[model samples]
Target chain A: MNTKILRNLAFTIFTCYVTIAVSETPHWSHDEQSTWWAIQDTTQNVPLNYPFGECGIGKHQSPVDLASATIIDSKSLNKLAALYDTDTAPVFFNSGHGIQVNTSEDYSGVLMIGEESFPLIQFHFHEPSEHVVGGKSFPAELHYVHINEDGRIIVLAVAVDIGEENPVFGTILDNIPHEEGGQNASSGIQINPAELLPADLDPANLDYYTVAGSLTTPPCSEGVQWYLLPKVITISAAQLVQLKDIYTNNARAPQNLNGRSLLSTQ
Target chain B: MLIKLFLAVSLSLSVASCFAESDGNKSKSLIDPSQQKRLSTDSSQQKQAAQPNASTKSTDSQSPQNSNQENKPSMIDFCRKNPC
Candidate 1:
């Protein structure tokens, strides 16, 4: 090989090494959830780890820019409450959306209250949703998180996208009780919140995507019950802004298989 | 060796299921540390199977309203009167 060519290759290798080391420096300082500490110096807390090793790792790592993917619009989303033997009845509560069914129990979408739980506490939405499908990221992913009495969370992630304005999402966006940065935003809007759901709901249409996930908040705990709907919902960019900050990126990038099974309920 | 490999994969799967179960359990608790601590008691673990069994029926049942509210009368004790 010519000495000049060899020298050029060596320089290229050197540049790659430098780039890697620089990238790694930010990650090394992150917490177990891979989030950098909330320091005053940092302007916006973005994931230093671009692609996480696990399927879900960071707390604020939500799915973003949702206009790209194709989602199946099934009728099942409408009847989710009826399937779990639930009352699409809405119960009022202090915080969160959806309805509080029979007592304080309520969550967004239809939640099946189980035995080994803190009982399903509530369901809510994060604007622009979270979770990505295949390699395509959606605008929003609604998380139907179930909590047992133990305070453990099993979050079923449903990815939403941008499309024609649906009445269900409109209800949610319209009645949203607490605006994120607003003075009155302490709690979410409460209504017979089940109305904000897609009609003709089919859990089967929701192809389950699972992986080890962490909370989207501090102390980002791993081992979450993640269910990603194969079908994405359409949400206008404007409607999404009403839920929460689209820029916060409240979702973890997909985690590694780590030899994990991504089960589909269908 | 192939059999052993199969067994190994099976073992990993079992372990993953346990992880999923635990993760599933964690979904509700991730909101608050105090809420989680309340759930970590030995009594709650005992209720684990009972809970999913109850929830699974609700989860898979075609009638979303009829799934698990069978014990609704007792839930009043749970909601307003209890720590919920």
Candidate 2:
């Protein structure tokens, strides 16, 4: 089992958390002077590449591998829409996905952050990403990022494990383009953001770790929100390999936990 | 400072290694079983799927740098030519 440490709203992560997407992003070009000329770009955040990984000391880190956690609230968090079906066009540029998501504008059944309807902009993926749970890791991690009119981020992370059939995942997995270049040309698999949430839905299991971490990849943006779910999900062997073969090691090891706290609604 | 950095680096290596090994098993599942299904789309994985050409944007386009992925690896090239 993933390291299920006593789930603690780590003080360092509280100040952060906010913040997923496509299977195989399209090709891109980078230039130093370009508008996207960011040293720690979103695609490659090559900080201190330690032999096994990088040593994140003063960095605001996430993905703390789950060890132990508690669910204060056991009540079911009402649902909006379980079946996420839409024609929303995802804008995957540079190294992230930017789609507008809101309570009114639905995708499967992902809830909106602020009251008013906001667009679920774009979501993206990160391997061994910054957010860690109870000090553990999953084969892969997914983030469903939604933003409000004011540009505030509400990210829902879904951990991926190996399994027989991921009912909710099949929707997204079945549609992900198996080939390259092909992914962008085609639309995403028909699904919603709700099915990917934990079965509990209780505010208790909803532990978070917020850190002032940068994008795991290049042009690593700073101040961006990083919401890491305490619970990790499962997928199939074939699916994991499919993901690995396409992107290889796409995750940018953890950063320094400059002392942040992980907040939860529960 | 050096000792702390060394410890941090060592912990990072172990963590990375642990992630790799744990991932290899692929049998254990997490509490949020539906997470896989719900994560149909998000910012990061979408970057892996197809990174848009930020240079060319319509009125509604966002900043490319704010999006996802460095570049698809060589393996994906085959799929691009053949497609699924």
Candidate 3:
């Protein structure tokens, strides 16, 4: 081989190796959740430790059982306020874990919990809800994930029950991509996040069960403020079946409260 | 020299192919039989928990008209009325 050609070939090989090693991250799956923390990166022909080891040792985890919560007077606390645009063309994707809807870059929905306001990042669905209310689990749960300027996460959760068919939820179900990692972005399909809630529940005077917890998914990053609405929204049994067919049993089991205070709004 | 270049390209393609295969396999192996059983058990437990009881109210109150009333029941009311 020509000397220069051989040198370039060697460089190309080295670059490919480096790129593959750098891009390959540890994979975590719900099937083997017990071994999530031990998931290895074998791209470099070596088992590298999982980067997000918090899943194994987080003190304050999420999806805590609300049955054991202590109700506190929320008269002094500011009412829950949601300022969402009625016409948002969101991109719905199947994340393998659940059906997640991502808002557009210009989407300006804001959720106000007390005085603090967080920007709505995205929302997702989980079947057989993560939070157990009064020792009972709902048919499903909807988590609206938000983040503030300081990177604080506030997840507003709504319990889903089997009742009347929600047109908005039906629209979401109809548009959601079935395959994992598949995304459906239809500009014609508009959704109002507020409509996903019970029509009668006032956004300003919303009552919820608030607790300090962490993300339910892998990495299980702590310090997330969770506000779960006790009042549930309904979907028809057929709608529930549609949702379950997409992603059943995606919810993480409830974690220990660990001395955390579960407060309720008035 | 041409043979040497061919070998080099083949090796690179094989490396890329291996990584792609690994990625595909990771997703395919997500839900095994044990995970399916666990999912079933979780569903059964959820069904049992969802049964009606004195502590829990009927889903009828979730209606638009009922929930919009001035004296709409709050989580506090539920906690106070029940032993939760």
Best by DockQ: 2
Per-residue lDDT of model 2, residues A124-222, tens digit only: 444444344444556667765444333333345666666655675554444444443334423443434555555544432344432223343333333
> Interface RMSD (Å), each candidate?
16.5, 15.2, 18.3
TM-score, candidate 3, chain B alone:
0.33
- What is the descending TM-score order? 3, 2, 1
Clash pairs, candidate 3, are none
Q: Put the candidates in DockQ order, highest first.
A: 2, 1, 3
Predicted structure with the largest TM-score when compared to the true one: 3
Give one digit per residue, the lDDT tens place, for model 1 in A1-266. Answer: 69999999999999998776653322221124343333222222456333333224333222322222222221122212212323344332223222122323343333442312233444445433444334445565565545443334455555566665656666544543343222222234444433333333454233333333445443234434444544445666666665453123444444333223232223
Tens-digit lDDT string for candidate 1 (B1-84): 999999999999999999888644322111122211111234333322222222332211111112234434443332322112
lDDT of 2 by residue, B1-84 (tens): 999999999999999999998666543334343322121224442332111123442221211223333222221221122110
Evaluated at residue A193, the lDDT of candidate 2 is: 51
DockQ of model 2 vs. true complex: 0.03
lDDT of 3 by residue, A147-166 (tens): 65555566888888787788
lDDT of 2 at B83: 12
Clashes of each: 76, 119, 0
